[model samples]
Target: MSVAKIALVGCGPPSRRWHGPTLTELSKRGAIEFVALCDLDETLAAQCGEAYGVPHFTSVDEMLDRHPEIMAVDIVTGDPSHHVLAKAIAERGKHVMVEKPMAITLAGCDVIIDACQRNGVHFEVAENYFRMPKQRAVIDLIEKGILGDIVRVRYVDAKAQRPFEQTARIRGLTRPFSKFGNSSGMCMDMGSHRLSQLRLFAQSEPIQISATVKRYRHSDEFISEDWAHATIEFESGAVGLYETSRLGESLAHYQITGTQGGICDHQWSHPAIPLRLQMGEEWKDVPIEFERHKVDGVDVLSRIVVHTDPQIVYVNPFREYAIDDWCVGHAAEIMSLADAALNKKEPEYGLGGRKDVEMAMAIYESSLNGSMPVKLPIAETTSYERILHEDYEARFGRPIDAK
Candidate 1:
């Protein structure tokens, strides 16, 4: 293939922040050709494509027809439209790379997966977090036996407010709904990354999820959340404690504890301890290129990795770009995908993305059912959105979408 031709579908914030820059970088590397762009909004498609000197279209069908040489379409549409847009491209026998969380519902994910299978095309999701250089190194330590018999993992992601909280506020809603406009709410929105991290480190299929997802204090809704927390039981006899929110104080902490060793994120350890690993007989900092930059004496390394264990760390792609959390894993994701596309390789993120959505759904299910434990593969006739809609009607005496 002479530089696999690719089209980008959906020009949203994420598309601009991560996808566009990464794809452009790949094009510069001569790994792929930016053939065309498509979007429901002509203005968005035109602006995005013109910026790259590529053709633009308002419809996927039109773009596909015009660019018959296109080898892949990267779909970054909203959660609700993910299944529809991806299935459309897959049915045309083109490989697809979808943005994270896969879909708003399991059925939607199933449809996209089945479509790709029937059409004989590759299907992958843009799951970036677990792909980070530091994160990958940490996971390797756990997976290799350095961690020694995994026991449990703890992860917390709390954002005081969400992108959509203000939009919901403007609507005069008595309660906050997702700004992502998905029925899965922030649980799936942010929960996708949390669960992916847990699954990656724990290396287990979840057996059960016990948790709660609530919307409280409509007036103070930041990004949108009262609170969300879950405890997951893994099939491998391991456990994970997970929490996330778009309300109240920004904090993130993650750690994987095992019989012999442990690794944690910056937030999980003490100030005296390095953010990487302070393990073994003596707590020495992991040997990283190791530079810390801060504002007002507070540590903030735009994006630096500690070479805690050189054997596990490989050459990181994010460093070449502006290294920060925003650009880190995302650049790695596209870089790996570009290589995979050129080599005719399927990606590692396909089934895992769908499972991430499923695990998030399980967390929401537990919350909806009075904080009881919900078993995996949740055999419920109820969809996650149905519960949210019911709650909305009860709170406002009308359906959630009522205007």
Candidate 2:
């Protein structure tokens, strides 16, 4: 079988968290060649290249010059440099998989997306929460009428701050390209994941978003928010309350309430809440089990079963191993890209769609603007174009139009 040749930019900790493991699995499956690795830290880049047995470069141009056959670039770089690297990849006619929070500012994201679109290059946002096996199951259940009508949703992401902070410091100091615009903070950082998940699970774009952030902890270099909370009103009138914090000891929870039943994931387990149905005035839980299966050669025990009843139940078990939750979606993202590359099909969430960028930018704007409700229009083309002009003016001291 012929494997696709790919390049990976920004070999930071996130690479370790998801991309590294996935690449290892992909290489073993003969799905990818990992053509080159690039990072600002030459030592670290060399170390990682040595460990992974792939070529390393301190500059993207050098890497591309060495391997022009690279089909796709996995951009694991931080926000600030995302636009430049992604634009470069797209200019080369290679597919790009960018990390979430898309770009630091709403404007930079627009330019990046526009360049990719004009070049007919594939761009994919690495928003992995929506791809978790169990999360997919819940979405399926909701679609299949097991949940009846979803009324409300609550999501919590509380995690240890040490790793996040330390990693951020390392990458920020070593990689100038990783910096985003000064107007961004944590809401634009981690909140993108939660908001993306909400949109995916609800199967609808939020009509209005109201959010706020608090920096209870002190960090001198970064003025970013460390905690964020928001209310998203979806088109279906299903309201979702979401919160994310970098200070919590270990509180990762989510719940969604519906007319017929609700689901919750308080224990950090997949199939977090496999199936639930309204039994009388009270909600009854329907248990679904799974058998063992190999996910990328790693043993994953997942169950997909349906419980037939006056209330039909469908369950899809989540996969588990040593990697982070994001890996679950990474698999889907790669497969989608492969299909698009090999089969001449457009992959899901091609490049940076207006809707995805709107979803991400709205959360940042809503949070920074005192949780003001921001309405999303059916067409957000103006939003993207305006942001691009604004960013250009800020940097160049003149409108891009003036030039």
In candidate 1, how many Å is residue 47 off?
1.8
Q: Residue-wise lDDT of candidate 2 within 71-168, one digit each (tens)?
A: 88888886656777788778888888777767765556666778778888777777766666666667777777667778888788774454344333
Candidates in order have lDDT scores of 0.70, 0.65
Candidate 1 — worst ten consecutive residues by lDDT sum?
167-176
Pairs with backbone N, CA or C atoms under 3 Å apart (clashes), candidate 2: 80-179, 123-351, 185-224, 186-225, 290-303
TM-score of each prediction: 0.80, 0.80
List clashing residue pairs in candidate 1.
Answer: 160-246, 161-222, 161-223, 162-223, 286-308, 287-307, 288-307
Q: Model 1: per-residue lDDT, tens digit, 151-215? A: 89888887545444543332211223434354345667777888998998898889999887766
Q: RMSD of candidate 1 to the true fold?
A: 6.6
